[model samples]
Target chain A: MNRIILGVDPGSRATGYGLIAATGESLLHLESGFIALPAQLSHSQRLARIYQRLESLISRYNPEALAVEAVFLAHNVQSALKLGQVRGVVLLAAGQADIPVFEYSPLTLKKAIVGYGQATKTQVLLMVENLLGLTLNNHNTADALALSLCHHFHSRWPQRSVSPAAI
Target chain B: MNRIILGVDPGSRATGYGLIAATGESLLHLESGFIALPAQLSHSQRLARIYQRLESLISRYNPEALAVEAVFLAHNVQSALKLGQVRGVVLLAAGQADIPVFEYSPLTLKKAIVGYGQATKTQVLLMVENLLGLTLNNHNTADALALSLCHHFHSRWPQRSVSPAAI
Candidate 1:
């Protein structure tokens, strides 16, 4: 059976999304990219754009599941709040489409993709490129793809089949 | 001309909203209430519920503008981030309907409602009741109504007419 999973890396100004189709032990990279909002738009306008774009993408791809990063500590509380806002919009879009969302921490995602929780961004990017056999143009997209792989690995792990709490 | 404005008090679990019509320096309350989500629902489900409820409210009232409180200091960074998330959903709903959003800080809202920025919750609630001539059952609804009144007062003040950025 083929299961399609979408991975999301949410940001206040830019959001990255990736699609992967998995069947049995095989996985194929479908699409990966980022949405960058206009600089002149207000925060609300940017969120609106994210919602609209994600809605359209979901309609087109019809993924079976979604994987997203959990909120983590940021240098500034304000930035963390903004990131959370973006994540909210991303979750809303997936919910509207009835897609089940799964969240992974940065450490878990890195470990799943690169075999180490403390792997650097460059290391993770290289591993994602090798695993998916695709060159990534953006770091955010690479992270999103890694999230998709993390979900795939977690789902297959005998003890972790049960999905974690959403959000 | 009858100008209608919608005010929103965004919350992760329960969101409050109010509608008011203004014409020739007169303000009349139209509707006010809150939407509470079940604790069992996932984060995305909660956000989706907020979006749908807000969209329905907008469609019913056809408000010309939306006023929402700006994100401010919370007891914890997690709470602030959650508030920002709810605010994002609120903004997305308003943006989808093409309604211009106006934001007011908590201090500004309190001052507009109770004639002082440091007014207590009971004081603001009483002033909201007296100003709009309606008994408010929920403090969140009262705050939402106060936000509407704030927009009205601020718009008329030549020095405060400039709208704040929507986030």
Candidate 2:
């Protein structure tokens, strides 16, 4: 059976999202984009918009699972708090849809995409494009696609005994 | 006309909530308590529980407005981020019900409840009990009540030209 996965990189001002379908050994990208929220709106207003937009995506894509980037150790406390709020909204959306949600740390995502935990953003982006056979406009979208790819890689070998061969 | 307002003191582990009804100059306390989420659950699961519980509270009280404590400067970035996540969940609940939400800083809440912005938690709790004619078992519920009271005081003088004359 084919499995569809939706990945998200949540941010207060903008949220990146990507969807992919995995069937046996092949992975196909279905959609990739970012949701840019207006800066002038209130925090709650921004969350409401995010909730609605994400809900629409869930309904449209009907992904069997959701994956999101875990919160990193941010230097700015305020920004970190804002990012957490965005993440909460995203989780709530996925929860409402009854989709199982997974999280991948930034380090793990980079390792999956570029064969190195401390890979540069450009290196990760290029690797994602090469793997998915498509060029992405923004790093946010690229990161989301990378998250989906990481999930695909991890889910294949549940035991973690050996890594799946490269796609 | 009578107006019911719900107040929330959002926390990652324990979310405090209070409901009050206002009819003209008189204020009546309806309900007050906290939702304690076990630490073992995943972040999304905890948020889902919070969303469901808060949504139920909104339905039970049928509040016309929702009041929440604004984000405060925290020494720990992770704690602040988690608090923001809880706050976002609270906001999503209110938004889902189409209830107007109001926010008050910790300083403003203390000032509204205890007549001093620098009041101690015990002092605020005592003042809340005196004002509402009930003893609160904990500081969390007191803080939530304080938030609701602050909204009541602020809404009276919509101009915010002058703070409400000592309740």
Candidate 3:
């Protein structure tokens, strides 16, 4: 069976998205990029831009599911609130398109990609590049791709328990 | 000139919305109600519901602007994040419909409605009822109405300096 998945790393200032197609035991990278919102735009305008861009991407990719990193403990209340606002629109776009969403925590993503829950971002990025045979310079895009791959693995092995916390 | 305004008090579980028309010096209440989301719904589903309901209201009332309470210091990080999620969809609906949004802090709302920034909730509600000549039992609905009235007053007197903090 072939499944196309879209992974999103949403932020207030920038949002990264990656698409991957999983066929049997092979994973193929389709597209990956990030949207950098203009600093001049108001908070509301930034959200509208994100929504419109995500909707366009969903339409173009026709992905069956959206994979995103689950919310963990944030640094502060203000940052958490800002992150939540971005996530709200991202989820709304998926809901409007009737796409199922799956969340993987940072620990799960690291374990799935780098064989260790506490692996560094560099390690995860290296493993993702090696597994997908593509060079990714942007950390956000690499993280998004890792999320898509994590979802793919989880879907294949439903019995595997990926703990939210570090193992 | 007459203008219609939509006031929104967004929450994760329940969202309140009120509409009023401002003509000359009179404020006429158009509608006020709250959307009570089922507890069983997922967080994403809750956001979708809020967005859809707000869109319907906008389409029905054709409000010239959306008035909402600004983000203040929240009780905690988790609650702040949840509140931001609700506010996200609310702002998106207004943005998608091209309705201008104006944010007023709680202090501003209270002062505009009750002539005192430090007025209690009961006092604000009473003043809202008196100003609009209607009874409001729901606190969320009353707050939404208060926001609408604040915008009305702010529009009429653009020179008024409404501080974010209490007097």
Candidate 4:
């Protein structure tokens, strides 16, 4: 029985999440979707909702571990700050569930999925579909799932070379 | 009639707010207090509740402008992140109400109210009441209100301070 993993691509406006079950060299997609909070809601409420929704999902899926995108700060100072807020809420949710969570840099996640550090959203999406045999738009959530799957594949390699042991 | 302004001090556990009507060099406290969201609620539900609560307040107060604290990053990275999320929700609230929201740095707010740029949190709480003629403990929220009042004062200052002719 291979371990199951959950992947989350987090954002303030909408978060993309994907779940997969790892079985030896192959992987299975269990579920994936987006969590959205419009620009209209207060920051606190949006965070709270994310926490609640995630909690429910965790209870439903009961994955062995969670893989989330590390906070990214590209150009927008205000956006980075807002992302930190969203990240806080998510950390709390993971903590409450006592689930071990792993974080991957955008570059690492992109490279792991598409063999390149600078994969675009479209490329990542297409690669995820090709790898997973899904005929749906994964968008951010699907991308996150791909990251999770990538991590699993690399970690389980007999060479132990996917991510560093430290990760 | 001097412009009326709403000031917000946001906290994940509790959000403080105040409204002041101003004319000339003086300010009148129209209403002030904190809006709290229990930590137990999911982040999404909290956002929903804040929207409802703020909608009522905005309709009732019809403030001319809004002043909110720019998100601050302190020592604890996690806490700062949570605060940022809460601030986002609050900013969204003001925007939905169609108020032109202004933000002030904590130090700027402190200097305006307490006469010192490096005022302690305790000092800020005390001086906020001194400036606004109130005696209460919602320290952080009050600080937010104080920030609003400070902006109100600064905005009314001779438009000549920063390239006066531009004003």
lDDT of 4 by residue, B46-119 (tens): 54455556657778889877787665454455456556656655555665566666767777788888889898
lDDT of 1 by residue, A57-85 (tens): 89998998889987756656677678877
Higher-ranked by lDDT: 2 or 3: 3
Better of 3 and 4 by TM-score: 3
lDDT for model 3: 0.85
- Model 1 misplaced stretches (Cα beyond 4 Å): none
DockQ of each: 0.68, 0.46, 0.48, 0.13
Compare candidates 1 and 2 on DockQ and give the better one: 1
lDDT of 2: 0.81
TM-score-sorted candidate list, best first: 1, 3, 2, 4
Residue range B100-119, candidate 3, lDDT tens digits? 78889888888789999999
| Model 3 misplacement above 4 A | A162-167, B161-167
Please identify model 4 stretches exceeding 4 Å from their true place: A1-80, A85-124, A127-167, B158-167
Candidate 2 local lDDT, residue A102: 76
TM-score, candidate 4, is 0.58
List the candidates ranked by DockQ, beginning with the highest. Answer: 1, 3, 2, 4
Residue pairs with backbone overlap in model 3:
none
Q: Judged by DockQ relative to the true structure, which candidate is superior, 2 or 4?
A: 2
| Model 1's DockQ score | 0.68
Per-residue lDDT over A1-167 for candidate 3, one digit per residue giving the tens place of the 0 to 100 score: 78999999998778889999999989999999898888776677778888999899899989988888878678888788788888889888888888878889888899889989999989988998999999989888888899989989987877886332110
